[model samples]
Target: MKFYDFGDIIASDTEFVIFGIPWDYLSSKDNVNSSTAPQKIREVTKDLALTTEMGVEIPSLKVVDIGDVSIDPTNIERNLREIKDFLIAIYNQKKDVIPVMIGGDHFCTFPVVKTISKEFIADDNIGVLIFDAHLDLYDKWDKGVYSHATVSHRIYDLDQFNKNNLLIVGTRDIDIPEMKIANEKGINHFDAFLFSDLGFKNLSKDIVAFFQNSRIKSLYVSIDIDVLDPSIAPGTGYAIPGGLSYRELWQLLRLLAKNFKIIGCDIVEVSPNLDAPNKMTSNLAAKLLIEFISFISN
Candidate 1:
């Protein structure tokens, strides 16, 4: 099924355009299959309640699920080009629509972000906020430069992004090399453990303040499912402890939407194969996507 049974075409009044990236060949783990996430998440949405937790009717949201990008898993360059062109086509239809992406892996975010950033006449006021368990700051990984593990670094390498405008949060699992690179580049990330020390209110404010201080007005958020505690979201490749709770993230996203113009967003790395029999991870992914849409809509 399509996301919330939304239309398959983008119209003039479309506020959000939802699409999927079904390629995961760039993920570091061989056992985990995140490639199935986009479809699985869509399938679960059919069983969800028609209204959001805040009582907003889901059907009223101006969203269209245009379906997944055609991907050849082994062909990385071709997939990147296809994903970029797919987004370009969406903008060709409507420039003001917010693109919501459901992903195969974190690497899927790279192409979408790259394409969206280019659409801006001046990217100086744009910022990127990433929610993940690992820094994903490696310049290269087992599969080389284009791997999922190198996604953040690749984004940072973009001409319009820098330490001030790009922030990574909910990090707990950090490899020595990635940590060293993050430190050397002066990249700032909020570790998961800080939630306990700072509390949710202060932490959320600080996140907003980071971009505000940098004079960032347009924000793009990327969420890796593993950023949540493993007990609650175990369907991701890396199950790290000391992650954010569902409520925490929900409130944070609410605050973010209130504070900045969220131009585009993506939720990635949800490995349905590793989820419980109840399909909790996919359900959570679906919930987060819809709720965020609701927040942005209101």
Candidate 2:
């Protein structure tokens, strides 16, 4: 199934391209099958186009689905290299084409960000806007360097990723190691509690203003489904109790779209293996992508 499944697939002058990487080789100890997320999200959203409740009209935009990257789960180095090469080819195809990636796990983000920084935006300091429950900044988790837990650290090591421009939003859980790293690097952390305390309106105001004042003109957004409350998104590896409500996330994305020029985005960690019978997580993930496309269209 293809995302949007709109019509004749256009590759040139595309507004956005959807790429799927279906390999969950680097998640923590849990054996959740996040590799199934790309197809699950596409299955739910393939035939969708019109907004049901938001009343936001999306302008006709060209989108291409590049399908999934084949990976041998047993070979992490080879897989990462393949993923990076795939992204380089896509970005090289067009100057400003936005790549919307549906991930196998949060680990998939390292390659996407690394490729964008190294190949496309090497001259600019690119900012990363991450919405997740955990920081994923551990140097090593379960004795693994490239696991999903260490994505932030690996991305920071890349020469093109600006440490100060890194913003982790909607995080509610953090280990001491990750916390210290985030603090020392001066990465912005806007957790669930602070967002709620500030209320949506004030938080949106502050966040929008923050991005406007920052040095980054181009940004990449990485959203972990676990950033949402379990009641809304339970199909992730880690389900933290307190998280951004669906509406809260929607509002935040809307603000960001209005304030910043988002170059690309990825929605990761939608594990159908952990979803409820109704598959609410995948459905919501689909809607989030749709809403974001609509938001950026405006």
Candidate 3:
């Protein structure tokens, strides 16, 4: 029921706190609802193995699933406030614990990143790394600025973030306008196709070197489930053609964990209603979250 059956209470030894934002009103898709993803991902975790692929015992990890943040589907501003407050509460309990968020949609990432960045010391060199199929860089979307389509742009608007410290990878389904915005702003993104040309290890090193060169010592990673190839992760709202395979992403996260202090992270945009009968996408989401947590714990 809970994520990996972790406790609901954060203790002194809690290294990670898991929570969800069950809202998807900002997503552009009309038929697909990702709001249920947080619980669906948790439910599928009931069947997962207790040890990570690398032989780490998951039950020994210091993680607590605090459950979902209260959300009003139609109230964007209020939902944002609540999400922020929820993360603040986690930090208040354990200032150094990593917050792992399961999402309602990519837009849910905006508030989490915003609130987590605020918890850092002013001099801390913090960065954001986003993995997505498309660049959610629209200055505004669907007549407003708070839509999921504009989540990256909203993070870009944050005073602490900039082109140098923000990176988007696993992109392949970008729009012309978003391309123009990224190009003009000098925001760096690695297209999905490059995985073949560069190989996984080299690409992982490049990603690590990117932050090292920027002098970024702390990171907040946001993963849109669509970043994984749709063949393996077809439950997202946007089932794009080309994306990173699970192994490739796992390698990248592993390398990142070794190189930077991942202060907070989120996995978003998984649409259970659109998934295959086996629910592979939600399963993949659960796996990635647990694996990444394991990497961080090590």
Candidate 4:
């Protein structure tokens, strides 16, 4: 394995291990530019504040920067195999280790869903909280299957794991046919309009309800950082104009942590090339991940 070695990360009792996957093949801004994401984000985190202002000491959770899995974007099939094997090693471990996955692009989500579904939920289903602006489910792309635009659809691509246990929030940029496709998959999309019409009080209750109603015990959250407004997170290749605010997302995470059992999750589509002073996107992603991990620990 050509993976980075944070020696004894599993044996030394680490709660979270950061895994980087730097390859977004179908990013619309430029072809194959996402190949540099892992390196770029690490460069930016050099000066990132480890603790918050209110003085919640970030836990001594052993964080090892285990680098990206080996893959060539030109060969999608081979890439998928390697990624799955890597995640299987993470999830199927006898000891407890939560993989905090950072991205190359949205397409990276497919291998994650595939591995977790087969490894953990082969007999029982697993639910996911998809926080994104777009409905990410194109039937096909470039006369080939499996692109960033079609990850959500791939979640159900497997025969055993395709149960209606998914709850999608912050979706405001779906095409007419896209909404129909989501409906056909039996997904309950709580659109951004709910935050406007129902208010966060009702919205939070709805989120709690979604998990409570699902038969699945484990929750895997996949956040496309574009779920936040462009003003706050302009570091994504495909960003929508209006999306969730930072504090609102925090509130949602707090609720998720308290209410559900998050098996594993990730944040994808962080493009450092679009960042402003202080690599705002990378810093924000790290802080957010830290908070979510803290919530899970508490």
Candidate 5:
């Protein structure tokens, strides 16, 4: 058995576990059921070990789904604080164990990153790898820094992560202004279409080298499932065309699995409201979790 309901973990034994955040009301659009994605994925991934239909299993590693952090839907401040405190406790308890999460909204990332940056209590620098199609660096304070669009900027203002430690990939539909800010500010952003034109294989090597040369000791991987093409992942709150196929994204999963020491990760924006005949997006999310566990198991 790999997982169960929340409030069930006695000790964090797995190298990675599902830190589910079920607060889906935080998005600018406020999509539902994406908050419930963690539970859906665990049902599919917990049964396999030592191998996968996608590839092979990781060795010497124990990956378990430890359920979710229960959120208070009535209050955002309390929810964020509670989420951060829970993450802080689990983080403090495990020096080596990495946290993999299924998200509520892109806004929920604020607390997740906030606590991952706690490793910064001693050293205030960490790398963040964002796998998404959106810049998410929209101007802040229009909504007073409390919206999903500005959450990453809020994390940056906290001064725990620096430009050198930030990497964004699969951004194909960004606006002209955002692209200007991203490039001028030295954010490591990859345009998916341009990347596809340039060749994903070359991009894969570049990403490997990016992690290898980073000055930071640890990283947080935040994935907005929209980075995947709508054809493969239609259930996300935001889906764009010309995104990575599951296989292309999986190449990264395999690389990051061996190359980078990811301290925390999450898959966000999976709205069950968009479920289809195949339930393509949620299923891919499950497959991604499976690959994550497969890598961690090694």
Candidate 6:
């Protein structure tokens, strides 16, 4: 579905473009029905109003939903290529349009990150802000290099992405191997405990200051729904306890939107099949995206 479906808001150039990738072959976890997340999120967003509580208006924004990318679960290489080519086309066609992607799984982030890093090749100023429970820094998991568990490792290997420019937030689940890699790469991270201790205001201030000091002018945000406490977002494949609260997630996005020029983003791992009948997980995901886009508009 189109993000807003406003018939009268037509223009040659759009400021935001929403799209989906519905292939979940790379997810090691079962119930790979996360491929259905894009449509589920669109459904829950139907009841949303045109403005956020912060008074950021969304109706006036020029945004379009280009639908899901054509992907084949059996063909992993082809899936990645399709995603990369699709985004490259969009950027080439509309330089100002920041793409917001709905993912099939956390692995969906690899291609998007790679594409954005290459898009802004002028400097190493393009940073990544990932809200995920896992470190996702494994070199390979279950004998596969492109699985969801190794997203950060692949991105870190990219020539355009600097190790120091990577920041993982809301992380609590990480294996010793992932931790070793993070330490070796000097990748910065913040867990749920630190977030609660620092509070939203101080944490946001520190994050923005870190980015500014590092000269990170462009950012790509990747949010794994599992970053939220499973009680709040139980539809994800991997559910971790003691995750960030919904309000905390929203506040972090607001701060990032207000402080940085977010070039592209993805919301991943919303497994509709695992959700309760209320579909609260999808509703929360939609609301977060709405607030984020609204903030970007303002």
lDDT of 6 by residue, 70-144 (tens): 988879888888999988877777767788999888999999888878864456688898999989998988748
Give TM per candidate.
0.98, 0.93, 0.98, 0.89, 0.86, 0.94
- The C-alpha local distance difference test score for the whole of candidate 6 amounts to 0.84
Q: lDDT for model 3, on a 0 to 1 scale?
A: 0.91
- Which candidate model has the greater TM-score, 3 or 4? 3
Q: For residues 1-298, could you state the per-residue lDDT of candidate 4 as single tens digits? A: 1112233355446666667777777565573355666666666555555554345555454556567888786778898899888877765653356676778788887787777767665436468788999878777766356777777777757654453677778988897776788778776778887897999779989887776776666778888888898888888876687799988888888788887777778888888777776678777777677778777764
Residue 71, candidate 1: alpha-carbon lDDT: 97
Superposition error at 91 for model 2 (Å) = 2.5
Clashing pairs in 3: none
| Full-model lDDT, candidate 5 | 0.71
Best-to-worst order by TM-score is: 1, 3, 6, 2, 4, 5
Candidate 4 backbone clash number: 0
Which candidate, 2 or 5, has the higher lDDT? 2
User: Taking the tens digit of each residue's C-alpha lDDT, what string does model 3 give over 1-298?
Assistant: 7998999999989999999888889999977778999999999998999999999999999999999999998888888889888988888888899999998889999999988887544546999999999889999999499988999999999999889899999999889999999999999998888878898777788889899999999999999999999999999888899888899899899988999999999999999999999999999999999999999995
lDDT of 2 at 67: 89
How many clashes in each structure?
A: 0, 0, 0, 0, 4, 0
lDDT of 2: 0.82
- What lDDT tens digits, residue by residue, belong to model 2 across residues 158-249? 87665567778888999998999888887677888888798878877876666657666777899999999998998988889999899988
Q: Using alpha carbons, what is the TM-score of model 4? A: 0.89
Clashes of 6: 0
Steric clash pairs (candidate 5): 58-297, 58-298, 59-297, 59-298
The lDDT ranking, best first, is: 1, 3, 6, 2, 4, 5
